[model samples]
Target: MLLIGGSVLVGVFTFIYARLVCTFICSLPPAVLARTVGVLTLFHIVLRELLLRFSPLQGERSTPARRAWLLSVVSWSLTGLLAIVIHVTRYPAFPAPSHLKFAVGYWALGGGLLAQVEYLLFERALPPTPTLSPEAQLRERLGRRLIEGYVIFTSVPVLVLMLTLQRFIYELHGDLRYLLEAVVLAAGFTGGALAVAIAYGRSLRRDSEQLLEAVRRVGGGDFQPGAVTSRPDELSLVAAGINEMAGGLQLRERIREAFGRFVSPQVATEFIEKYARHGKTAVLGGSRRNVVVLFSDLRDFTRLSESLEPEVLIEVLNGYFQEMVGAIQRHGGLVDKFIGDAVLAVFGLTEGQGDPAIAAVSASLEMRRRLEAYNARLAERGLHLNSGIGIHAGEAVAGYLGSTDRLEFTVIGHTVNVASRIEGQAREPRPPLLFSEEVARRLGDAFTVKEVDTVALKGVAGEMRLLTVEGEARSVRAA
Candidate 1:
């Protein structure tokens, strides 16, 4: 709108001045008006050419303020010269019968043009933007987007007003036309600059808000990937930062899930992230606690398998083990992997909990329940189901291991061996589950346990005191 208005004003004045030159001012002037117009045109073009060819816009060092100031000064100088040439050519008529007065007018107009450069000088005028602490500064820098709205907005209008005034003055003498052009150019440039600044500020503020939101989500551990898309150039840096943060969290999650299967969730979390480092490797071992250990073994497995096809026997064993593991996991127990048809589990090794003895007893009860359900279906086929479980409560060494070549996540100690020995003792008429006196002592106060005399375990020297928990009168406890 400003450009079109300025152009119309320039056009109207041009037509009027052309009429005056043809009929009244310089009569039959052939090259006079044309020459003046050509000179003025060459002058403004030269001003524009300075920016295009000589302006040192190299690399990231192209300071916009410096460019604007230099361009403004050159533009004002060219326009001032154009005005003076027209003034001296039409002397006596412009300054109203005085030479000194015309000189004063020319000097004032030139000074006014020079003053317009002040608008572009902003480093000394505006306040600095907000900054972050050293730790957060890297993240903030990654999210900023540099916009070009300022350059396009200011340059478009400044160029428009300058071009319009030059056109109007080309045809006319130094009069109201020159003053009107100055007003239009100054107002247009100033307004354009403010509008551009406001737009840039709004866009920057909005981008800043979004980046902050992304940072907050990362801190909160909400590591859903692909939260933000690319925005090209400077903005792409912000998206990269978000994805990088999300990736860190995703790695943590993978480690957690993998370790959780080996230990417990709480222990898994501490293992991957909280362990202290000396050089670079994690030095802190896994958290330790008194826990319930249970071991089970398939009785008559070799003979039972000898009667059936390998495929059917293997399938049956897999199905039975699957059911048993599910029962253990559902009751807050970790399956310490499978050793053929033998199953091993721990109750409180990785967790800070109640009592290991009670957990073992409760697990034994549930295991028997699951076994009966299984045997009921197989009873018709005479595929007798026989298994024994042993429970023990004691210390265990639970941590990541496996020389340096392979990493194995596990829990191992004397308690695991003791539990296996007890399981072996629960053969034939002796019952399906056996527990050590130490494990029974750790059970909840309500359990009715029968004391069984000490029996020598296979590896350990001392005979182990044992007990048998009959049923649900025992409240399960996990350490």
Candidate 2:
């Protein structure tokens, strides 16, 4: 539809131009002029169609200026040749004057200049290709600007040259009437050219403004996809790129949230930095580290689960875990895993500013405090809960373990086993918190602990001394 409309418009303009030149300037007969106009119009239409059909400036890498120049030269050259042939053949006896020939040549030159301007406008309206990189797209835009500048610069001089030639021809022939006609023609052509240039410039400006606004919105974190334009242009590619970038950021945020649920933020950050720097998996194999491990188990949880409704039991367990995990995390510990009603946490797995044993002891105290507060709340509802915690500090092998499809991060060795066994000794009538002799020594004067007894643990070489942490007294009668 667009091509047809442009062709029709170009044909009409060419016909009018041909008739005006033949009637006022060439002084050709009516029949000859009519035939000439018809020929010119037909040729104009055919050339326009061909140019549109096989446009060179349709791809990312095409030279738009060169294409426009070629179209202008061909269209105007054909017009000049056809006009001269028709005039000479129709009036063989009365040859056209030299001034008329010069006028025709100058007029054709002006038409060619106008055609170049129109070609430039058409190229500017074309949408940008998406496959081009940003740098390539920028270069293309700069090239277009240079072409538009060339057209404008050359257009002014050409129009002036045509007007100067017409004035000289009229003066040489001493025809005042023809000179007035020449002035009128020059004004009309100049006005029309200015109008076209102004309109094209305004349209280009509007599109540029829209693209700049869209870029600003994206920079400000507005991920809302812009309205897609029907034109296949550079602006559309920019909008698509912005939408893709925003989607990637949103996905990354969701993944970070999920990761935080399973590991401490510090550990997660360490893993990310390590992966970024080394490009190697950090959790695939065990590394021996002096880490403080803490294990907490709810006393008689099996009996509690049997007595309570399933929903109520789950609610209580979630609430208890939330409080306990909060304490562990607050003291720089990672909650490794939850087994039934027991939680295993590790400290000093990553770099820490303070002693890991001290952090573990502080976390255990906080857990007891939180548990007391939680029990007070449960007591109002005629329900209660109790838990025991055991802390141990030693070298342990910690890393990911499991099948290729599934993996679990945990610490293992004598340290972990001893911590779990110590938790088992925290039954009714005993202090709800116990630690190995190593943890007590590491605590120094930071905590008050008493030696409980020397007892041999399963799969251990000798009897190990255990100590019970003592501080703010609390009721553990429920255990």
**All candidates: TM-score:** 0.55, 0.55
User: Which ranges of candidate 1 are over 4 A from the true structure?
Assistant: 1-183, 205-230, 244-271, 274-289, 308-310, 377-384, 452-454, 472-479
With candidate 2 superimposed using the best TM-score fit, by how many Å does residue 31's alpha carbon deviate from the native? Answer: 57
Mind giving the per-residue lDDT tens digits that candidate 1 earns over 1-479? 32123223332343344434322334526465455545544554466456636765322332344344445446545554555567467754543222222122122222232223232332244222343233233322222212233443455456445544554454455466676768776777677776666676556555555666677777787776344533454655886778787887778688779877665565566556555212245543454656788898889988998898999888788778867877776667777767878998888754554455665577677777788898887777778778999988888887766654455556788888888889988886677788988776666464777765578999988888877865443434321
When summed lDDT is taken over every stretch of 10 residues in candidate 2, the lowest stretch is 470-479
Model 1, residue 450: distance off in Å is 1.6
Model 1 TM-score (2 dp)? 0.55
